[model samples]
Target chain A: MKTIKKVALTALAAAGFGAVPGLFGLPGSLLAPGFAATPGSAMAQECGTITLGAALSLTGKYSTNGLHTKNGYEFAIRKIKEAGGVKVGGKCYNFKVIYYDDESTPARGAQLAERLINQDKVQYMLGPYSSGLTKAIAPVTEKYKIPMVEAEGASRSLFNKGYKYLFAVLSTSEQYLASAVTLAAEVAEKRQGKKPSDVRIALVVENDPFSLDIRAGVKEDAAKYGMKIVIDDRMPRDLSDVSATLTKVKALKPDVLIASGHSKGAATLTRQVGEMKIDVPMIAITHCESADIIGKFGKTAEGFLCSTQWAETLSYKDPLFGSAADFNREFKAAYDMYKNRSVPYQAAQAAAAIYVFKDAFERAGSLDKEKVRDALAATDLMTFYGPIKFSPAGNNIAKPMVLRQVQNGQYNVVAPSKFASHKLIWPRKVQ
Target chain B: MFGLCDFFAQTCGNLSILFAAPVFNVQLLIDGVLVGAVFALSAYGLALVWGVMNVKNLAQGDFVMVGGYLTWWLTQTFGVSPWVLLAGLVASFALLWGLGWLLYRLVIAKVIDRDLFTSLLATFGIAIVIAQVLNLIFGSDTQSVDPGYESLTLLGGAVTVAPQKLFAFLLAALLAAVVITFMKRSRMGQAIRATAQDPRAARVLGIDTDRVYAFTYSLNAAICGAAGALIVMIWVIQPFYGITYSIRAFVIVTAAGFGNLPGVIASGLGLGIFEQFGGFVLGAEFQQAIVVGVLVFVLLIRQIQQAMNRQVVQ
Candidate 1:
């Protein structure tokens, strides 16, 4: 045990000396005063359940993501059901969701959405787990003119595509990438105490559409900030070898490593970081906060940084968070699983999107799909994540985002001082 | 910056370094070669079985995965260091050997006199059954052994190699060489070879051909077990990933032609370099597509060679 400790100490020193960005260094320890006290949640008398449609991939490649979002949606439904329904404008309407697995295949998602609209006659639609699948079902939703809400497919241009009925819960892909650039600048200021523009960066992706969006977003914004993208190359999606990629990361010795992949593939990444002990810090843009990925590497993900939607350590009980604490508490009591690991932001986003549509329908005062579409287009309501103001087309959003840093396997907000519970954990130490 | 792929190429005029100069190119090669070695090791045992037992082992990869799951369990349960897990592997292999001998007596011997088509389908079914069983036991959570290398650097540029990976590469080469030499020189090796050449002749010469066949299969499985153990030290293992490894192994064996250890090593490394350079020119997203594409390309080449062989025979 003593020897293992000595070796671990020696290894960490050698890795730090290797002159790369440190491992996850953001302090996950600080506690947010949490959500402020809020008035009692509006309760409704059971007024019968109104069904919404979901064309989510329950199985196959995107199943893992779909499953998580489903948990979020279900947790929301459970909350509304427990409270007796949505208390809106003095009328209570129950929320019921109709879900189709879609199996992560594009064709199935399209067919499933069509079935939900026609056969099930669900008033609104929810859930499509991938960009391609979401795009496939977009036309279907538009045809019926039912208000569709999505947590997946953060493609910047999706909601931008002249659609009046589609609303998104999370930030657009471009917004997420912008957050990455933002983190890079903050890292340099806080850790390197140097100009953000001077920081060197490497761009690694899976050579897929999702990753491509990230790379393009970085390149487009990189020069604006004067940050040099020293390395830009993609490893294979099923990358079994990462030595060459890591080697280049070592040689270029960039200030940051940008990686994108599934949870399984991402596991090898942190382990490799521990092994070669490369100095450049890494930040994963998508699916990096996965419990499976982080759990495998443990402290190896310590100093790494990412722009995330939810962390278990957050004080969701704040007034700004609204019913997020209720959702979290209910989810834990029911499932015995923490929110961050099981109920990701997408799930909450999807469920809340449905509620927004329901409220829009109630406000519009009719099920005329087009009227609901107009109501969604004009919505300025507040939800768990804050205001739901959308642009004319409903793509570009005004949702507030908070930065998260990992410390000893926990995550805490490190940016946007109002929401920040802790100091920035930059260039985190592996130990 | 031009990136490290060219960092050394510019200074040393080493043309190969140019292939690895870009970070993307280097990463592609790293994934390919490290994975390629694993594929080679998995396929090596199959080649041995094909050569000695006169039976193509379609169920070979499934055995490799089964061995891997056992190792994963032992290490996870006992807190075994990866290096120390070799003993657990030996014990597991011994058990597998006993199972193999029993299988030979009850099933394989009954089908020994059957045609190729019959044997092939039967073993393929066996592969499906074994894979399903292992998948049930292990689940699909990508298991690996983290030795937590200090990530040493030897002054890298462009295609900078991780010392841990470099060490793994060296380890694969050394292991392959030792296993091949053992098979070539041992008395057991001669007996296995004798049985493969002519079972009737070997039996008449007092060799227990059945025992030889069963023993060779067990040793083949043991080699595969060792490969699995070493593989988790560097790569993550999943139940379904065995198919990719299996296909790559088959492709390398065909490219190198069976029974040539040096040729197999060359072919595996050659694919690794191709993938690395391919990422340089093509996109890395299709690297797996490229691997499968090259596999079909090699198959066509083999088909052409077979046609040429047939013409010569005529």
Candidate 2:
């Protein structure tokens, strides 16, 4: 008891150092994780090849997405190497992919992206499979003026800042969940055989910028169609049993439910709805595209129509179909061996951005940062998965979200009259 | 009606409305209870070291993390399920036990008669070094080894069990019970109890008190290791995950007074339920903050209570 008493008192002194004051700021950003690997310091060993930096997670909570983005990046790397690498005015720059493990920490990722650009001084950079990390390192890329073609980050604010350095291949934030909102609205609109005078909608989102953006975009679009957002409050990611939030949601009794969050969070909310037996027709934010919910919760994720810039299988029938087929094939081959969740969006686009960078540099006829930035900003090329284009603000809003639903426990592209590669299924009956 | 009244007061809404759907709140409470059991079981080890070992093991959390990764690797590499992995967990804990013994005998044993500041620094260093190594070996991936057991819903609401987590809860309780029973019933346990009460006297009585100390230290570590393995079955496991778990264990262990396993278990369940309520009412970002805050608050109260009790006795 005396020993325990003495030890218990230690917390008082240590409480002074435990002050976590605004960890979101740039100062905490610089208090870097010490495990960072030196690039040109040692990586110069493998010389005579053009170096590009990739800081991606292959493991961690975000590993599912990280691994997928790594695959996408690797896929592009393979394609780049096979084509004799980047062609700057027909002179091939044999690019060496300098990959590092960021481990999904925001501060660590910011420090690492800084190291990659400043130390090794790689002319170009790629990756990061999480929006949290991407937000951390976005300033670093902008500071250096290195045009990073983003394959996976979906924090719509990345473009809101008018940073020309970062270009994303993924969809805008949860607020811009065009496919999900449009699908829910159109189906209900058509079901009523006319546009309803009052389309009551409720917004349930995770407390993250990614989810916030999707929620915002959904509201923006809803207002455009004269729909009212009934409920808008951000819940925590770990708040799994959504009964309290959903009860409020059910009471508001919105005509449509626009749920936005990470895949696991999305799975929890969707599954809880099933468990609680709530029967409001729903649409998922972008995270609905991943295979975790379909795999873990199985069919509970079915009928959750979602808005995504990419899907796993596209019919190749639609002219504007996001490259879900190409992504699905390459992702399965690279993944599947690791018994983890399905591919995350961050992994997919971060990988594709490498090829986009290659194409941009080749088109510019120079490796100059300004020229490549211009080349990337002026990009109008079709990628393996989607028709690649970035707005002046560095967002590829051109690739409108392709709505999808879980049919028989698989992602099926279902909506947008032109991109309707498959028919939309509803009311998934749990056996 | 009071549940509703309390709900409305806390939620600042109609308690009747929140209480009408007890499904969500109850489910969160159950999950919390199970999770808290795991936290309490692990925390008892830290409490034991603080109580009997007289040296706070800051590395207790890292041990949980290491033990979790070890179980993950064991299952992934050697085809061991959580049930079958009990033997392996015991062996691994025994290794931790040996390490803790070596650490205690070599370093901490000397510092036992010294100031609290030095022990704190030494243990903190041990924690950082262990955490760094695990980060390197594991490459910082979040892994859930859930064997995809169907979720069981009670009262037909959002409370769910992956079946694996339910088992982990039982494991935590059972292990905690065994430890409690051993302390209460065993001869060595009495000696441990005796030494904890009056170490100088126990030594004078031919207890070979150092051996007793070393044995208790190892036993505590082995228990912690088992708790770590059980945690990974329910939640995602990462290298640094132990740090959070460690803090959680410390919180519950300290709040419970470390004298009773049931108390520790109750406190752990209390924390889980508190966190679940926080998630429900406050928001998720505040979940960790709430846990840490409650822990700090409870510990402060306990320390003050102990200080007051000591002054009164004097």
Candidate 3:
């Protein structure tokens, strides 16, 4: 009888320990104070705090961009505080974000989203780093009726799901590399004096939803120009090498090569292209700034065209962040790690997401989640990142994805004619 | 279902490409063989530990990552010369040897006499701890070191081989030869071999089996460390990338069977070539899937061989 009683007590103790995380969302709340208390103490004291929960990829594959996203959010919050916080319902509230490390996994992302909503009682959420992670957490936020202002997820499929509570400030993934294809066709028509249909494309993309959607976009655009896809390869997720596909590129001699993966994929592709001396006439890839290709690869990355959602040289401005170039300069001054490197679009759009939240909160004039979400849907504002206006589908529709070429170690916007800040370097020279 | 059809179409297209340009076969073969040389080093370490100590170490790849990180940090922090990077290889081996001894004293020594599952669980726990600690120290970015050597292009640049990869293959071979020589000629290696045959008999013959186990495990770690240092120079390493290496080691050892040195080398190279061909024909996405599929196939073949050896009695 005594043994049975002891067994029951032990079981109860074990169960209690297991339930602690679910009950309190221990890591999220424990990390919240340290992350939130860093901005402006005097302003925070004067204004009530509105807590926003974020489940970011703080420790896994996406951690590099995830850290950038986190830094962007924190930087924006600090700026907003210095600008006197968000005024809603005749009261000002400073933003305080509670962070949970999602470890770059979809399952963990969804679980953390639920914990943030149910356990921490957080009504507002900021998105995780990648489209894959955002897809995982969107259903949870939708189920809980919590509004999420996501900056990173650009997958077109994310919008087609008819999610009411999910809002994104970045352009969709399909638009990411479509401009590259269009540029390729334009080069063929103008320079080579050939039909657009004569252009050949080689695509090497990561197998994830984000890169695959980028692939689909490129394919759709390429088909519109009647261009042929010579080599279509899906790189593995943990991409270390893509030499085998590059070998095919050499044999086929495709006119243009478009590659998309996250930062790791970008780094690997850039490194191997240099080592192999792959001489494709034109090469365009995503996440070049995030990967720091110019800093890492130097001469090898000179002619590679990079697709970006935002560039510092753009003539975008707002009362809070001044100009797009101002945001770039001040952000670098605030974060030491970004010294000697350009601020990536991943970080820029993240700060823009926070600006969207502030705009919606001020316009709604209430603390209700549904009202803020409706305001987010109705948002039309120009910020340092870009002009963000959400379509009924909840994606920012006012912005266009720009193509930038690495000329003389600087990322200069060169495509789409209107956004061209520099001449497009045609037939990229081999190092 | 659409994915399956797409894969089939891709396979056919890739096969035709191979037939159309046979020069690519040379490129694939060269890449596979070079990568396999590095894979063999880690698998050889795993085989040594598994054969001598009867302990299945799931932390084999973590030891490699630790070595890679140490070399990368040294290169990045000190801006070391290529010659110093070579010295860093030896330094990593010695450091990892010490680490292996420390781990044996703390955890492995306790689990040595336990059941197989206990050793597996213990080593798995060690793997997680090592990965997490490395992540904390270095962050989760994928890092690699360039050896500053140019590549060799052949067949009108249709086939290119990085000089770093060739150097790594040669170094791996030299290391393997040295380890094989040491195992054959050294008294400690003889004791380890004897213990593997029969631990009780070796104990009766006045061999300190505990010390032999420690030395063997440490030597295995030292080999894996050297291999990892070479890998960082040629390829890339991340905190979470260790598991793929661990899986590759298991595949090589399982296919080769532990204690067979020649078999380990051959099977490692064979697996590498197979993966290259498979990834080339299918997409690079199938590279990991191919490793797992090989493991399952090898395991099934082993099960069948064991079943065949069993005699039914009436």
Highest DockQ scorer:
3
Task: Report the lDDT tens digits of candidate 2 across residue range A1-431.
Answer: 98887777787645533344334444432443322222223354321255678787754455556766776677667656665666676555655667778867788888989888866667677858767887887899999887777776777777778787888876677535655666666766676555743767767777777887777777778877887765665766444335445545544456677776655456556655554445565655445645256655565667776666655554432222135565555556666643344455455565557767777878899767788889888888676456668878887866666777777776677877676767876434443
Better of 2 and 3 by lDDT: 3
TM-score of each: 0.74, 0.75, 0.90
In candidate 1, what are the lDDT values of residues A1-431, reduced to their tens digit? 99999999999987675434233443322222211111234573336455678987766555656766787777667666665665544656666677888966899889988888766666578858878898888888888777787777776657657776787766666555556677778778877789989978877766666667767777777777899876676766556655545655655678777766555546666666666566776464456565354566666777665666554444443232256666555566666545345456766676566656656766877555677778777777667655577777675366655566666666666755566788766665545
Higher-ranked by TM-score: 1 or 3: 3
User: What are the per-candidate TM-scores when only chain A is compared?
Assistant: 0.81, 0.80, 0.88
Winner on TM-score between 2 and 3 is 3
Q: Would candidate 3 be rated incorrect, acceptable, medium or high by CAPRI criteria? A: acceptable
Q: What RMSD, rounded to one decimal, does every model reach?
A: 15.2, 10.6, 5.9
Q: Give the lowest summed-lDDT range of ten residues in model 1 chain B.
A: B8-17
> How well does candidate 3 reproduce the true complex, by DockQ?
0.41
